[model samples]
Target: MQKKYQKISATSGIMTFDLELNSEISKVWDLIATTKGFAQWFPELSIGEPGVDGLILFDFGNGEYEEMTITVYEPQSILEYTWDKNMVRFELVGQDNKIKLRFTEEINEKTTHTPRDISGWHMCLEKIQGILEGKEVSFTEDEFLALFDEYQALMN
Candidate 1:
């Protein structure tokens, strides 16, 4: 899997980067739809949606959890939804044998950036990239814990 952009939003006006992967839409879709698929990368997700109108709820196990309501689950174009107060959109396009994905999370100014959310998304997308391109991601459970700890530190 090729990583075009991987970093935090250190710029004004744009706090997120656009990451595209090389894979089919079906493979990409499965990563977002199935609980087992995401569980491979997201260790805090105790409950998740595998269908439309489904809600994904996860606790970082710090007596805090975030819940997102599913809004869209179209096969090839979009998967848009509200996770907590943040609005996330995933758009897909087919380029030959590759699936170009755009994952965007638009947050209100009132909403401060939580590192846990940031790191979790980062790891998950990386795993997705690996899966899409037929590469192995070395994201172990302990690795997830370390990432989560880093995020928690940033948040607090």
Candidate 2:
């Protein structure tokens, strides 16, 4: 599950990851595009409207939330939204007997937090797979640190 990193510019970049899941495309779509499905995995996000320019709220607890806009929506195939200053997109493709989930993040600018954020996205995708496999998975700080190191190396 290694991510592909591309330095698009001195201050911007792109990261892409692909995962093959032995589940229906709809199931994978639900997890990444629906509120209830995200609650089971990435609970911080909730989809408000299921279309372009829709609102996606990021709950920060205690009645605090940040709003993200849905920039692209193509039902079960593509979902793209604003993530802070960057953009995050998810694409699902069904092939043969498996569903391919493609995630891409367009980094607007390079920051000290880039590596940490990249590592977090890596773990999040892994969690999604674990859910589909019905396996109990935990994301620990140690695991994130190790992944952070790996992605941080790419910055150099």
In TM-score terms, which candidate is top? Answer: 2
**Poorest lDDT segment (10 consecutive residues) of candidate 1:** 5-14
Candidate 2 residue lDDT tens string, 26-105: 88888999999999878999998879999899999889999999999998799999998999999999965599899999
Best by lDDT: 2
- Summed backbone clashes in each candidate are 1, 0
Query: Can you write out model 1's per-residue Cα lDDT over 23-105, one digit (the tens) per residue?
Result: 66777766766566666666665336644777777776888877777788776677777766666677778766666777766
Error of 2 at 36 (Å): 0.7
User: For each candidate, what TM-score against the reference?
Assistant: 0.64, 0.95
Pairs that collide in candidate 1 are 23-99
RMSD of each: 5.7, 1.2
